[model samples]
Target: THSGTSLGGGDDLGAYFGLGTATGVDRLEVRWPSGLVQVLEAVAVDQRLTVVESGLLAELRPLTWPIEIGSAGGSFAYRLGVTNLTEASVEVDVWLHIEGPKGVSITRGPIRRQLGAGSSLGLTGSQNVPGGAPSGAYTMTLKVGTFPIAEQTASFSFSKRRGTGRAEGGGCRPGLGRKL
Candidate 1:
């Protein structure tokens, strides 16, 4: 995270909220080069996995994907913006996972069927990147999973034309172009 523009890493990796009071709270032990020592504890306790705490003033900054794939009254066109200064409201379960190209999958569930409270829901949805999903860089996990109590994890990953006639750069090139 050193050269990632900003975010120093703590407040348990939300990096700090409202941006203050996280001074030198370190926990280091990721050694390698042949010394070997990392049984676990980067950050994940895993009890069926749940970590609910997010009045987190801000962190998911992605604006204007602006619905780039729309047809047939529009099904899901990928317009995920984010901002919730927190009063109370967040039910984000956007999980559409499809992997192929030696990593297989034809479906994965839950893409914002419903969510409301405290606002900020530009999370449009879509799936079926499966033209035999095996070309390259195919790992889409919009898996917010009610994440951090839904205060964050307005997840990301775009480019859903999944090329075969080979048109992988921007948009509109896979056949059947259905309802968004």
Candidate 2:
């Protein structure tokens, strides 16, 4: 049986089975949403185990390391690879999360795509840094399906840029701002 929740409510995302005094499961079968069926033998009982979809791979590749952010803010780009190694085509949903300093977080789409059998798809995109984001370390997490497949961390630092200053009064005067 599957779990369901009402609107504005939450529920546990786990499946429970009553073994009825059975010692362990001899076989376990899972039918995934992608039309892929997986079978496990000799499964243990009374323990939590993560089941990752077979023949699907997700990878995160950052174009730059230790991203630098200026006072005016900046943007970072990355490449994501999703491969289907099975004999049949499957549909996948990709999600991204970037967690920054001071509990700042950014979430990106469940970008849905269909991949042919034994083929790979590349997704490239950039994310803008909020102007008020603090300079510190950040982590980007990639999730394929319900599993987090990859994670990468980078540092963000503020760089000083020159700006023109205005005169105290309305007079025509030009001055340079303070250098960092």
Candidate 3:
């Protein structure tokens, strides 16, 4: 059995079942805490399997304007839409990460929210880009769920305006974004 402690301690949550002289099992059933059930047939033995829940969908939509950065800094805003495809309300965690040129990475949140069945929620926010950041392509990634049930990415670029000493660029280019 898998167990844990509530007193700020750690426990191994892994479950191991030994099948003597058996090469495989006929079926496996997993009942999630959220009341979702999954079944696997003809399962192979002696290997670790990672199962991810698939009751949510996420999409990332960046503003269609160029990101303008002045001497001090600038901010870019985006909208993330999440949909619950299940029949019941489910709680999930959302995370946003901005990765820029030269290994500059910024994390926005692990915001937790609950979505009703067949309902959608839009999360809007902005992220600050520091002054003098490298001029190049950047990527914004959105991840949803406690175990990453869905993910999407959007791309943008930053370049110095000719003779203006400022940086400006656009994301959400046509056919540039993709889901993962």
Backbone collision count in every prediction? 3, 0, 0
lDDT of 3 by residue, 34-147 (tens): 655454546799898766656766676656466555544456666677778789998887777666777988765667778899999775655555556665667676667673
Ordered by lDDT, highest first, the candidates read: 3, 2, 1
Shift in Å, residue 3, candidate 2: 34
**What would the TM-score be for candidate 1 when compared with the true structure?**
0.23
Per-residue CA lDDT of candidate 1, range 1-180, in tens? 223434653333222223145342232233333333221213332223233344322222223453232111112234334334356665455433444356465444444433344555443433334334344433343334353222333234443333335322234323212321
Off by over 4 Å in 3: 1-53, 65-72, 147-164, 167-180
lDDT of 2 by residue, 76-133 (tens): 6666766777899887766766666678776666566688999997766665654456
Cα error, residue 14 of model 1, in Å, equals 21
On a 0 to 100 scale, what is the lDDT of residue 178 in model 3? 28
Off by over 4 Å in 2: 1-46, 50-53, 146-180
| Alpha-carbon deviation at 157 in model 1, angstroms | 7.3
Model 3: which residue pairs collide? none
TM-score of each: 0.23, 0.53, 0.53
Give lDDT for model 2.
0.57
Worst 10 residues of 3 by lDDT: 171-180
In TM-score terms, candidate 2 sits at 0.53
Output the lDDT of residue 62, model 1: 20
Please give the lDDT score at residue 82 for candidate 1. Answer: 39
Q: Cα miss at 18, model 1 (Å)?
A: 34
